[model samples]
Target: MIGAFCGSFDPLTLGHVDIIERASRLVDTLYVFVAVNSEKRSMYSLDQRLAWLEAACAGLPNVRCAVQNGLVVDACRKAGARVLFRGIRNGQDCAYEQNMAFMNGYLDPDVETVCLFTKPEYDLYSSSNVRELVKYHQDVAKFVPACVLKTLLEQEEMDENIN
Candidate 1:
């Protein structure tokens, strides 16, 4: 089965990797869709984010990456993916994802959304936290995967040089 994992992936944290790895085990193919919403601004550009994601998921055969600049459900359907993989970190995440899941169901009944709870070790890591650390120019290597960290650090250095 083809699955769609949609998120801002501002910096692609370990939590996102955890979900993708888990979903890859359950599905035949998993497409990591980086959400590029104009209204919900992101710290990194879509090109940068997708590059980070692609590098992070390099070795995973079942996992591929792409960028979608519109509604997630629409993108999922357009991609011919019937399952949506959502990673839940806690109650707060569940509450928010639940609404989105219901709304996605309402919009496309055929596209099923499944929630995968985060691995205990990654429960505290989130994209927002990574973004905060990046904004302050703090070391975020420990929070995200190596590939993501590498890209972020390189980008930061480039930005610093530009400044």
Candidate 2:
């Protein structure tokens, strides 16, 4: 069974990696779909996000990274994925993902959404929070994966150099 895990992933967090690793084990192939949302402003570019995702999944042979510009269900359809993976951190996430799952099922009955709970250690980590911490010159090494942290630090140095 092929699974699709879709997210903006402006900066891939450790929580996201955990879900991807777990999801990869359950399916023959897991597509890490990076969503492109034009309305939302991202700290990292699409290319950067893809790179981070690739790095995060480098060791997982069954995981592949790709970009999606439209509905996640459409991406799943294109990838021939029957399962959609979602990582839920709290009740808020669960509620929002449940609605999305319902709508996705409506759009494609063949695709099923699977919600995975994040580990307690990673439940508090979010891309937005990590970005904010970086903005304030705070340490975020624990929140994000090493590859992401390295790229973020490099980007910060570049920004400092430009200024």
Candidate 3:
């Protein structure tokens, strides 16, 4: 079965990678949809986000990365995915995902939403937190994937040089 996992992924975190790895195992093909919203300001560009996702999922042959311009259900429909994969880290995430799953179900009944609870080790990791840490010059090696870390470091170096 084909599954779709959608996220803004301004910077791909290890928590996201863990979900992707687990989700890929459950489905024949897992599409990592990078949902881009112009209204929301992101630390990374869409192309950078897509590249990080691709690099993070390089080991998973069944995982593919794609850009999502609109609703997640629409993206799933376009990709012909029957399952929508999501990761829940806490009660807040659970509540939010539950509502989204309900809405996605209403939007596309053919696609089923699957919420996977995040592992304890990665439960605290979030892209927003990681971005904040990076902005403050805090070490985020454990929170993000190597590819994302490398790029972030490079960007920081470039910024430092410019300043």
Best by TM-score: 3
Worst 10 residues of 1 by lDDT: 36-45
Model 1 stretches astray by more than 4 angstroms: 159-163
Alpha-carbon local distance difference test for all models: 0.88, 0.93, 0.93
Go through the candidates in order and give the C-alpha RMSD of each one to the true structure.
1.6, 1.1, 1.0
Off by over 4 Å in 2: none
* Candidate 3 wrong stretches, greater than 4 Å: none
The full ranking of all candidates by TM-score, starting with the best, is 3, 2, 1
**Regarding TM-score, does 1 or 3 come out ahead?**
3
Assess the local accuracy of residue 94 in candidate 3 as a C-alpha lDDT between 0 and 100.
93
Residues 1-163, candidate 1: write the lDDT tens digits: 8899988988789889889988988889999999976666788888888998898888999888999867888888888899999999899999999999999999999999999999898999988888888889999877998888777778888998999
Write candidate 3's Cα lDDT for 1-163 as tens digits: 9999999997899999999999999999999999986667988888999999999999999999999988988899999999999999999999999999999999989999999999999999999999889989999999999999899899889999999
Give the 10-residue window scoring lowest on summed lDDT in candidate 3. Answer: 36-45
| Candidate 3, residue 33: lDDT | 91
State candidate 1's TM-score: 0.92
